[model samples]
Target: MVRGACTLTAERADTDRVLDALPGLWQGFSATLIRDCRLRFRRRSELANPLIFFALVVTLFPLGLAPDSTLLSGIAPGLLWVAALLAVLLSLDGLFRDDFDDGTLEQLLLAPQPAGVLVLAKIVAHWLTTGLPLALASPLLGIMLSLPGHSMGILMSTLLLGSATLSLVGAIGAALTVGLRRGGVLLSLLILPLYTPVLIFGAGTVRLAVEGAPLAPWLALMGAMLALSLLAAPWAAAAALKLSLDG
Candidate 1:
């Protein structure tokens, strides 16, 4: 009976320690998030590159194809998704390059908080700077593609959710290649295949919305994918970062 009581007391003590650490962990996360955002914003041109690429690809598609509104509308879903995917890819090569160059990444790994938490903060920052802008600008691009007015909301919604997953998944590739001199091509090779499902479901959701079909299933799938990525990608990326740095 005495031993049982002692065990319970120890468990409660550990629980209290964890509860005490929660606020500090949250502050670390927020500070990292804010710092990343401010640093990215400082480089105004780099911050705009993905958005520019996204717009240019969407704009040029109409020029190369027949100017039929129905045809443009038909292809818009896939085109937007592919373009957005590539744009995200283009920005990913530099995700960890700056940190690695300046030795900040090594410090991040040594911090008291888990590396995954800091990496997840960076991923969120990437989405805020890159993916969020793409989702917001999609409506104008959708109009250019002659997409149905009602379907624009769906396009934005899918991009918002899909892009978060992209940032998470892409971070793994970025972490893996951060030590490479020229890992851009290698990064694309590593992550492009992984991106196929996101492309399919994201575009499919928009297509269904255009067709006036029920899109709840597609959105649900996207949410599931985002949830999985949220849970797993940060830890995977953190491990990769450790490997890259150690090697």
Candidate 2:
């Protein structure tokens, strides 16, 4: 009876500890998210780089191809997706680099809250600044690419879902390379293969929409990917950040 009572007491204590930590975890996450967003905003050039790249890629594609609306429309899904993917990649190299250089990253690792929570906050901030804008701006680019008006909604929706996964997966690569002097090239190499699945599902979903096919299955698959990334990516990125710091 004494032993059983002790086990129950310990379980209660553990539960209490988790409950107490919840508030701190939320505070840390919100602070980190707000701070990162503000910093990115202050750096206007950096903030605009991905959007500019996204637009430039879509704009140039038409000039290089024949002035054929049908052909452009046919290829629009893939073209828009590729532009967004590259835009995300372009922004990723600097995800953690500024913090690492300024020593804030080390402080973040040493903070009382779980590193994964803090890292997830940064990832959220990244998506807000980079991926969210890309999704919002995609319809204009879609029109330029001669994508059918009917598919514009799907294009934006797919990008909204897919880009979050990209940011999560890219954070792992960013954390791993945060300490390198020249990690951009290596970052791309590390994450591009991981990016393939998102690219496929994102482009395919839009393509299916353009073709007047059912979108449920493709959207379901993309949601699964996003869910898995949400569950796994932050912890993976936290571990990678530790490895980078230790090395």
lDDT on C-alpha atoms for all candidate structures: 0.95, 0.93
Candidate 1 lands at a TM-score of 0.91
Q: Looking at candidate 2, what is the lDDT of residue 140? A: 95
* Model 1 Cα lDDT, one tens digit per residue, 137-225: 99999999999999999999999999999999999999999999989999999999999999999999999999999999889999999
Native-to-model Cα distance after best TM-score fit, residue 129 in candidate 2, in Å: 0.3
Ten residues in a row with the worst lDDT in model 1? Answer: 17-26
- What is candidate 1's CA lDDT for residue 25? 72
Total residue pair clashes for candidate 1:
0
Reference-based lDDT, residue 84, model 1: 96
